[model samples]
Target chain A: MTIEGQGAVPGLTARIFAGHAGPIAVVVLAIVVIWYAGAVYMNAPRQMDVFKRANADWGAVDLIEGTWAQDRPILPAPHQILAELKKTIIDQKVTSKRSLVFHTWVTLSSTLLGFATGAVLGIVLAVGIVHVGTLEKSLMPWIISSQTIPILAIAPMVVVVLGAIGLKGLVPKALISTYLCFFPVTIGMVKGLRSPDPLQMDLMSTYSASPWQTFWKLRWPASLPFLFTSLKVAVAISLVGAIVGELPTGAQGGLGARLLAGSYYGQTIQIWSALFTAAALAAAMVVLVGVVERVVVRAMGGRP
Target chain B: MTPSPVQSGPAGSDGDSVVRAHGLTLSFQTADGPVHALSDIDLEIGRGEFVSLIGPSGCGKTTLLRAIADLEQPTGGNLSVNGVPAHEARLARGYGYVFQAPALYPWRTIERNVTLPLEIMGMAAGARREKARDYLELVNLSGFEKKFPWQLSGGMQQRASIARALCFDPDLLLMDEPFGALDEIVRDHLNEQLLQLWAKTQKTVVFVTHSIPEAVFLSTKIVVMSPRPGRIIDVIEADFPRERSLDIRETPEFLEVAHRVREGLRAGHSYDD
Candidate 1:
């Protein structure tokens, strides 16, 4: 029997499109619809209250319109945040502290620095734990317990203590990111480094391969998939760490400072814009990591 | 003490055994109790001999091969390879082993995979590449050198593993059911290739398998073993000429040897129930 969809050209196109892009588009559309509805629902009561105090005769259309375009509503509409984004990210000079691009760069620098440092630290620890039985037994429990303490609880303390030692700005923020990001890397790398099959290990023994050779030839390459998976999580968490670090210090630059400033001034639109920008930034960084993982894994003979 | 002059070994040669084990025993300490993997295993593999160990499940054929390769530690008994203890033999890289699976590193090209042992031994880059090329060609995988392991079929992967095991020019090759996972056609084809490879290389091989015909077809000596203490019960010799083809399996002499091997296996298996 012939496959039903094999030779149907239009059906193939539709199926391919529907397989991925279609679901994403539908989900996005649904989110926007819900968001607009929520914006109207949350903002209308305040607008009606204002109208009642002014003894104004307003219809439902006027109330809905008024609520949607409020200057300081509790929840900003999607278009309002988009307008804010365009103003800060596009209209302003990137060098200006007010520009979101400037803030993003500040946050991004710390994220990359923290991610790099954390990844290196994690891999070194993993290697130690895998190769050294004493380290695995001694350091593993400590490493696991390190993540149990909340990053938020520790972020402020880390900032304050590091500040006392004359460390400020990017280094302190990055250190916080390092703390948040290192756990995943350490955990993932441990699993990855131990991922080689018993038979492969036996083969190495047959060849009289040294621990160093076995590591370089077999364990490292095999662990790459696990390392990359951890890297994605680490990078995203790094961004969060940077943002959180900025909060306690009340830093003069970066997305976290923007969020703080917006909150102090009751600029709901600004807050919403900064929050969305942070989200988009996280998504972009994760995708970037995913791209690198694909390249490395494929080069290592994994299926594309 | 040195091994006694035990001429009763079914496949013993004229004092040139590459692998010699006397009263070898290995047991594992599991949660329940000590499990005897191999008990009182006495084996001697002569130079350039192709020996097959055949047994049912739980048999210590693979363990015996591993013990010879120094991958297992025997609780008792004396075992030697290349006139030295098994550990020393391993440290000298005296043998190459092919596992049940291909075990090729996915990251490396087929040539690089073949050169793994050479690289570990710190061979010169040029020599390693040249040797890889020669062996890949020997395995009929020359053009596929730059390709990865996953790019090949299961049969091709196993052949590449064989090339890897041979590229180091070891005098002994220990194979653990190398073709057990392949389909019947592929297994038959591989068996033929392996026999030809053995004839060409003249390396002593100790192969582990459970297939009766496979043991009969490729082995100069067939070792029939039993499980649950995993002891060898019988050894049968089939002294076919080196250049003989697969057609020999149909001959009366071949069938007679096969029949004997089957009988030995049956005799050993009777104790299982």
Candidate 2:
């Protein structure tokens, strides 16, 4: 049978363009233009200082070209950052400290470890808050207050305390990410676990299902969509947490270490490359979560 | 204030009543005050009877059904289901409840939704699937077993919910306006289908509805109720034949019963104070 709206290629193409691709292209172009402009603007003074040292005269065109190609720009151009990323991630050996991939692996390990701990902790807390009234009354305010304390301020203390006890390397960093990751999962899961309407609750009571049975059959699957959404947000912040945890410790490896070394020597291009790599890593983690969400929601008979 | 006369129950029913409530009263403790939902409700629903509790909005029809299902405890009453207290009966899996909305889990297929209670009861997977299939076929939803709740229409979703409720084959079914959301045509169709299913299964059903014609068409006994401090106004024996169709609604006896129900509702409003 011929379907009127189904398999309408031109309409589908138009919709995809209108909904996603066109807007993405416009925003990306705008960001690139602003970034290139910022690079030239920020690097112009440093380049001019060099020219002045040589007692040489220059114009805007020279400043623009020199700024884009500077060995150590104050703010690297987008193309320069991209080139550095390719060199560090693609050309350099995976085992080399200079390779961004190696640094990413070091950072990613802590992020994943912290994320897993945080996710489990958050779910357990959420379950506790949901099932136990006293926990809900006492814990929610404290959980919110904990987030208000800046991670940057807490990271050093955590590192030092752990270091004093001879706990070094990954644990401190993973703890920070774990700290960052658990809140959203807890809050989102609470909302999801309570999502079933009054009528649904009444139906469950009629079946005389135990609280455990109700959670598995009704609450958990219902909470999954919310959990995944929170996880996407949590995973992104987890990468940030790892990097911050690494920053205070001055670890000899990881992206955060690379950033610290760059800043110490005023190698702005190196700093920018590390920052961009971190952002890309975070995006990849979020996308990974999104893929898992689709697979799980579909497995549970949702439309994905 | 004049005393409201108490009606015992319908005659001509056999020995056992699935549900027996004596002066069942439920009140909610709201911020404003205690809101009396069901007051002095003495209802007896015998075995294999299709009883409909018809009332105005906020008249405790749903509350009464909920009490029967053991979802809510009556504030002051002696309520029993299957000769045991409501709570015990619930724990014994004595009844299946169909809510006002379909309440089907969006993440489960139609077949899976039907099998959920069975899974909860720790039935074997093979047995659960068999029972689900049988009930789905009974509800005329066999082809759509793999379809999710959202994929179906409102009527289809409600039917799937009914199948889920019946898959476990509970001796009693408590329905809270199961088709109140459906349009006229679908409601009529489901009403007819439910009657047929009732005849076939011999399960005692306590259905709550706002529609008089619906109550008349589906119920063996019609309970007319009124609002503020909700109480039953009249209990009328419908005495309609088990083997019948929607066309029976046009008959004189049906009209007489419906007329009595309307009068009971009008009489309820007379004592609104």
Candidate 3:
């Protein structure tokens, strides 16, 4: 069928334009403008200081020759970070042992493992809570309370405890991610399991269907939207947990370690680059969940 | 228990009474106390008969149908269908039951909704498809099979529900105010369609409705029920011809039966009060 004849294409296109295009354009424009303005303002003083320092120290290579490139103690310019990103990704062997890519891969692995573990545990717990009223009434409040304890404060203890037992590398990081990722999944699943309408439940009862059948046919399908929503939240939290886990372990790899080293040595450009990488990773994880949601719901005969 | 009044009719050659209830009493445990929904109710419906249980809102007509459908248990007395207990009859010989509202599942397509009972009965896939198609055509919803329930209008949904009920070709059909929510024009059209359906299927139908003309137009027998502690007050045998039309409402014979049903209703209320 022709796209217009299908009765959905125009509306879909309009929605994309209205909801996404405008905000994205505006945000992109604002960020570019702000970055350039900040670059000019910050670089003026830094360039003068660099010129002075280079003239005193070595020669004009630091002052008049590539002097603008040479001198920030912290808060490096956008161009500097971009140059570093290109050098690390292309010129330098980033995928090798010494590169940032290897560390990023390590962090990504722990984050994914932790997220999967947490999501499965959370979903199981949610199913149990939904089926058992006592668990729902008693355990829900405690789960909520568990989130209040800061991961930053707990990370050191976790690292120490695991280290004492000679458990290191990815386990502690994955556990932290699991801890952060599970809460949203539990809450979302509980809401989803309870989402079936009274009439739908009554229909199942009229069929003399067992509770298990009802759950399989009705409750599970109804929970899909909520499950995906929780997945998005859990993925972001999983990244946070992985980052926190890296903080106390004195780990030499991963974005968290890069962030720590950059801060300690006053390499602001490295820190910002790592932060951006983490943000991109989290975005990628959420996008992956969105893709899975689309595939699943479509398989279940829903119009995604 | 008091015996039901004699049916006073020549026995049909087939000798199949589709439904028979003896001294049926139904009570629900409400917060206040035990509420007698139905009491000492005795009814018998013959094969190919169309009967309407006409009563006020709370007169337990729907409750009686539910009991007959094995969806509810009678507090006392025996209810049988086709020579067996209602529950057993329901399991062995399935009965089509249409609730007051169109209880079509929202998630299912109209075709799937019609085939639900067939699926439940474990009918073969090919036969189920053919039967669903036939019933959708019966309800004049031939082109809308693939549409979801929410996409249809209320009248269309009700039609789909009726189609679903008839999909299994059950000998007995119990409808609870099937068209009470429709507009007058739609109700008249549906009544004609329903009579046509009855003519074709020749199934025993026990329908619950409050409309006097509806009961008079559709039913071979009108069981007028009373409220409070609900009980049958009158049973009117409609003398209207078998092949009825919407124009039957203008006839004197139809008017006489309508008058009788109304009087039965009034007398039922007065007797209760």
Candidate 4:
């Protein structure tokens, strides 16, 4: 018997969309609407000045259109940024320097490298902090103080110093990302590694398990959830680091370079497009980490 | 309350003593001041005997157990396990201690949980698996090897934990209220199974519980204790048969022993003022 035509029964597809996609769609729509309004408000004076200079009369509709369609508006409209994204990311060849795809790849490489190095560094530091009392006392203060020195202020110095030593290109940029990302990872991991309850620790002691064995069997696994959590934050911030790294160096490639070029040219659409692309990239990386977390949690017999 | 007379080592036909404590005391150096957890505890547990420490909260029954397990450092007194110092016995893996909570690692499956101690002790993979299998079967958890700790009921999880404790084949089992969190029905069932386990393995069991029925049901000797500096007030002997069942609880002999334990517990509380 078909259960399709019951009274007041919403279709499954409709129900699914209502529960999951509906709210997100509304939020995005609201954001786009607000963005469009902000664009017109910011760009109108420039359009008005252009019209007055050209001795051309313009109605409200013309003025609105002018603001939205400006060659170099103060704040580009959503459609303009989307058009620029399509031109650079989809229309242009990926190998082309003008292509956002190429730029994204350049930035992504450094981001990944920095994230890997930073994660390893963070884990090592955390382990040392947990196991060695002196390291905890000595290294922790310095580590905290290191983060207090603004990354932006340090980024240029790091680039210049590393460049002087002939360590240029990806290494310098990745190092900046490493600097920005490692703090969260270190803090999260220290907490995670120590997350095991007293009972668990007591159990290990009872088994006469070596400290090494205890670390591998109990602390490592216990720290996994925390590690993944820190990784998501680390990955996202590392992208920020990569972008900032590109800024001081005036890099020839990368999303940061695209943003730099766009800012130099006063190409608002290009800048906004680069920003959206960076945001999408960060989201993708976090999602990738979350996927791995799910797989690990499931494998360890937890509900993913 | 006066300290109970120290039970001489090698009680009855149980042979040599497994755990012997003389004036065992633990004081936690708290912010307020030093807090006595256990004071002047003296006891001797024989091989292959089930001994239960029955006391109220803050009575140092668990502290005493922790002392035996070497989980807590005794500030004053001499304690030995298997003729060596408690710490040394722990290093030798001479005993397995079970906490009030199952404390099973959420990440490990039932069988894997059982094999944890073996893995830590560097037992080979094949051997660990075999021993895990045997212990799981012994605890009646054979088919649920792949199931995680969270998948099982509270009683089952506790049983799996017991299997984990037993897998390493430690001659002495130190359990601190293993079934305290469980329902009365589950507790009774587990108490029976524990008795069967103790009988089969012939291992010395030091159990901690607040329930008198549980203590009388399981222990061949019950150490009734008091709080406020935490000391034992009385030690009562339970001479029930080794092969006894749950039906033994209804027997006149079991009730008499249980009544004596209740009196000892009340008498321990009388000096609270």
Best by lDDT: 4
Instruction: Give a tens-digit lDDT track for model 1, residues B218-256.
Output: 888888888888998887777788787788889998888
Query: Chain B TM-score in candidate 4, rounded to 2 decimals?
Result: 0.95
Return model 3's CA RMSD, one decimal.
6.4
Model 1, which residues run further than 4 Å from truth? A1-19, B1-15, B271-273
Stretches of model 3 off by over 4 angstroms after superposition? A1-23, A35-81, A90-94, A97-100, A132-135, A138-142, A153-167, A210-212, A295-304, B1-42, B70-93, B121-124, B143-145, B150-153, B226-231, B264-273
Which has the higher lDDT value, candidate number 2 or candidate number 3? 2
Error of 3 at A298 (Å): 4.4
TM-score computed on alpha carbons, candidate 2? 0.94
Residue pairs whose backbone atoms clash in candidate 2: none
**Which tens-of-lDDT digit does each residue in A103-169 have in candidate 3?**
7888999999999999999999999999998998899889999899988999889888998999897
- How high is the lDDT of residue B87 in model 4? 91
What are the clashing pairs of model 4? Answer: none
Candidates 1 and 3 compared by lDDT, better number: 1
Best by TM-score: 4
CAPRI quality band, candidate 3: incorrect
Question: Which candidate, 1 or 3, has the higher DockQ?
Answer: 1
Model 4 Cα lDDT, one tens digit per residue, B53-108: 99888899999999898888999999999999999999999998889999999999
The RMSD of every model to the true structure, in order and in angstroms, is 4.4, 4.3, 6.4, 2.7
Query: Per-model TM-score of chain A alone?
Result: 0.93, 0.91, 0.85, 0.95
In candidate 2, stretches whose alpha carbon ends up further than 4 angstroms from where it belongs are A1-23, A57-60, B1-5, B9-13, B270-273
TM-score, A chain, model 3 = 0.85
